[model samples]
Target: MACSVATHNTKSNPPVTTTGSDSDSGINGNTNNTNRLNELKFDVFESITNFAGNFDLDPDQNFYKNCTNLSNYFLCDQFACKFKTVDTQKSFSSIHFNARSLVKNLDAIMEFIETLHFQFDIIGISETWCNENSPPLNIPNYTLLSKNRNGRVGGGVALYVSNLRSYTQRNDISLTNISCDSIFIEINQNHGKNIIVGVAYKPPDVNSNHFVDDFDKILTTIDKENKLNYIMGDFNLDLLRYTSINSTQDFLNILYSNFYLPLINRPTRITSNTATLIDNIITNSHDLPVTSGILYCDISDHLPIFQITSFINDSFQNDVPIQSYRLINPLNIENFKQDLATNGWDDAQMS
Candidate 1:
């Protein structure tokens, strides 16, 4: 409830004002800002994000010219949609972040979805209250990976991938296991590539990092036997602005010690700061040189950061994958659903 926000002390930036225009926009004041806006807008808004991400190995020389850069963020009126009205939209891909509510309007949701269909390679969703038993959704090139907390709402995350069968990893756990756990997964690159793509949401709590530590443990388990990793999610803690309780900087110390590096560079832009950065992309410190870093975005309610990490593959690491259950029979599914219908879940309850 009461959180201290952080501030941006960066001075290199020029003043920016989003010009109100009908079919087009004009910013005759600062061409430099316009160039930066143009550069950031194209790749950042193109829904089908396809950045190579951070691979610790020095890319095959001349990679800079070929390396992909994808940074897109969304805030749908309700659930997001792909739009067709914008005659000139990127075709590479599209991604939509929807916050559908029980009390929200329906048309606005459709419009947003129309806008979203414009482009997207992968899509991450939150606040979707649907469970495993619900009828399948009819979305093209889109396969859903959801963890529904309950039928009412709260604490859920999912990924919609195209050609999902080619990418492997399909989770068919029931509503009970899904509700009881947070949704976090590593979507590695094609052909056993080592990049681990992830998404997460933090509940409103001060002891959030401890929960993050649990998430980290899961990462540890996954990467325990496999190396090379990259993760992005709503971390909910801005180390620059937040400090934990119980006698000292245990959380920050642990986070940094684990080689966690937020996607932001030094003197990041202010996006409603409250002590620490609540939304972040974390990777090993080696991914960045501290001097050169990723671009920080302020388009959504949360600031999103994108890193152009150096190339260098990590040493092979082994991690024992966490024991995850698979749906066996009709009885197991019904029995698990019954258990969830009663106890449900609490945000405070972390594994």
Candidate 2:
């Protein structure tokens, strides 16, 4: 719903694995903060956001003073990152990337995060060949979630968080399709939303529509449970334009069926290789207000994605602008099937 397409290809050697359920304080589930979740969400009812965070008593006389608050803090420490007009002096903060990748310098992942200097709540990444037990680790104030492909080289994901405590991280290990989708759930003190985040990657050879079905199923499961969801990932297909197999209609089916909307301010180039926009950040749009639909470029082959929406300020309203987003979509697959059947796998059959 956020990023569409670009031209880039990043590679890593050997497969890697990241495992374990997350357990962070302040944001973990079962902490008994249910009463405050909606308090932090946006409200057209109020002009000022109801976000809850650590409001600095005496914010530094720098640009960052506008960024930080009493209830929450920066997720990254980067400057180039576009913020919600909060702090100015000290740059925005974001979570770091996984330490391991199939290619790039082994430390390229961490090095990139450190250099950017931004605070992030969630990061949807690709090009990681993660194996079991060796998941990217030791990151401060965050948790990880992802699905790693078995026979692939560079395909995996990680979802990190700050302020909110993470509950569990699960991988969508599927063989029929070439997608490593890692999903996680976290309990936030503010807003009291049960965030469902997934890090997904679909290679060109994979059935993009099948991946889309898997993605919609996740949202459906989350919605059935009545959990407010926010999903991020690398959905190899482009949403703006449509592929006969994976077109705009395909994407709309999933989102519209689930009554969801695209998160604002997605990435133009999520892949690190070329300038292709394949990353995204999508949410139940009706729940948000004043969100960013797109964002700027960065040092990596793929650009970073973000979102910023207004929610009600329950007991805890982090007002965490989903600033960075990872493009991830599709639907109406029946048409694709009929089209493929009526025609052939290739275009010649149609005539």
Candidate 3:
């Protein structure tokens, strides 16, 4: 199955090189003075280059004192003083991994998270293998929302959202309702529309047609919400064989018809014998700038996939007061009258 790909164009500019020459006849007449001037120019250039390379320079150094004079030079542009402005855009990052059994690899997973350069807004885990008897698991500064399979041992899905973000779980379309291991949450934005994020896990043993039908229903429910949607998981259906497998083709058709594009094209799970593209992150937010890829890690058989979406901040005036009023209905009016009549007005008047 052919899919549309987005391309980006980057413009590159050549670096500027500077050279010093003694053009004055007076200076040229004196070779020693000309050589001295050339040496000085070389020293200055080297000093600037060294300063740019080293960030641990002393605050009281002569280089710091001369920064103002050097600001006129192109090489010193980075040292110029400027006011820092808050960015008007924010990014939402998410990562999904099939841990196989989260209980066994919790320590390794935490260590892996600590190694990340940036914090992820959402952490999705499939095949958690959690049951009612499973121990409570926690990650610092994150709220856990999980749906564990009851009366079973293997299938479960979990979502961990940063405490800083405001969100609400969507129980209406819970994965349990569709007989799948998944969880859905709506991320609340201060000004713009909210974003819906879901993580699902489809067992390989299940009937593909039933899975497709159930997944289609979930997509339909999400489409009706009309919000930016990101659905990720290990569906266990190799997308590389979309053309050959009817179920895989049907799955892609459902996603494409709903405007959700799968971002991961390369194989996510690889072994000595075979490689398959079963893990994926699909989203309907085509307009938003997104970067996605798989992270090479040894935590599990399947690699981790991540997506970073940049959303333009929609600023709103906080000073504007929201209008509010109380409703005056017959029931409220009667309740008010009954309360008034029930009060000891005669006793108060006599007092």
Candidate 4:
């Protein structure tokens, strides 16, 4: 569960629909757009200093070598990304956001990915505002699975999964009590692990008690399966303040009881007067190491949270140091002497 979050206000202007082109490869598109943005920024900053020398920056040299494998940047002529000869480990990368509406800001979302060069295997979107009749979002290499809010315009949840792996939407969990738009997807990892990723967007108007009860049921249902779980999205509850609100406290109590850990600690939403940590990524996989953090971007009113689910190789054994000396067994001395007596060393010395 590699995840990322972006901030967007719910009350912003109605987002314009930005359809994806046939050429839109999420990962590649981001790289190409980032290269272009860097080029433009370079042209401008170069003019500021009145430097006339052509800026022949090498992409391979400028980008971090360990950020990704070199094969990803093959578009840069012979300057492919240099990679270390190391074990190739698999990982699931994802981004989560309070999109407000997918159709309205799809372009900016793509642009955001480009600017940051974010690589994701899945994207969880909250507040999609897309319904059953809306046109299909045609991103090149991902399939969109969404749950729209009925009879409403502002709430919906979606998961855009990369086509590289097989996945299915899990419909067993009930959302009636939760009072939010939500989605669940079970990703079939190529490395033989199944990861269940759930995204939810709870409106502020919903009754907290009811929300908690419903959320508890959802967790109970998921916990029974015992699969690696990653739940994220805009809960609309400020986790930073447990004492200020009963709902916040109850919500956290349930999480702790189930061994679910909240990965984002910093504020995810901020305004002139307040900074609130409303978005989060929760997980219960103790054996598998998970790394997460907050991404400060203006794609939504809430900051994007990125989490990575990495595969730890179980094939290699760690080497232990050995002493330079050894002790001889006392009981084997007679056998050793007999074996030494049979040696041709004495005959060779005589010869």
Question: Which of the numbered candidates is closest to the native, going by highest lDDT?
Answer: 3
For candidate 1, the 10 contiguous residues with the lowest summed lDDT are 43-52
lDDT of 2 by residue, 1-351 (tens): 232222122333312111122222122111122112212222111111111111221111121212211111112332334343433221112232322363443345545555545445565556566767453454565555555656655666665555444355433323235445454654433234555555556665666667677777777667775555666656655543332334445665576557564442222342212222355555553423333323222334443455544443332244443333222213334444555577545656556
Q: After superposition, how far is residue 70 of candidate 3 from its true place, in Å?
A: 43
User: What are the lDDT scores of the predictions, listed in order?
Assistant: 0.38, 0.42, 0.65, 0.60
Error of 2 at 186 (Å): 3.1
TM-score of 3: 0.64
Q: Pick the winner on TM-score between candidates 2 and 3.
A: 3
Please give the distance, in angstroms, between residue 161's alpha carbon in candidate 2 and its true position after superposition: 2.8
Off by over 4 Å in 1: 1-121, 129-139, 170-181, 186-192, 243-251, 265-276, 285-300, 303-351
Candidate 1 structure quality by residue, lDDT tens digits, 188-283: 443323444455555544355456556556555544544444454454444333322421134444444453434432222232211123445555
Per-residue lDDT of 19-38 in model 3, one digit per residue for the tens? 22312122211233222222
Residue 339 error, candidate 1, Å? 58
TM-scores, one per candidate: 0.46, 0.53, 0.64, 0.64
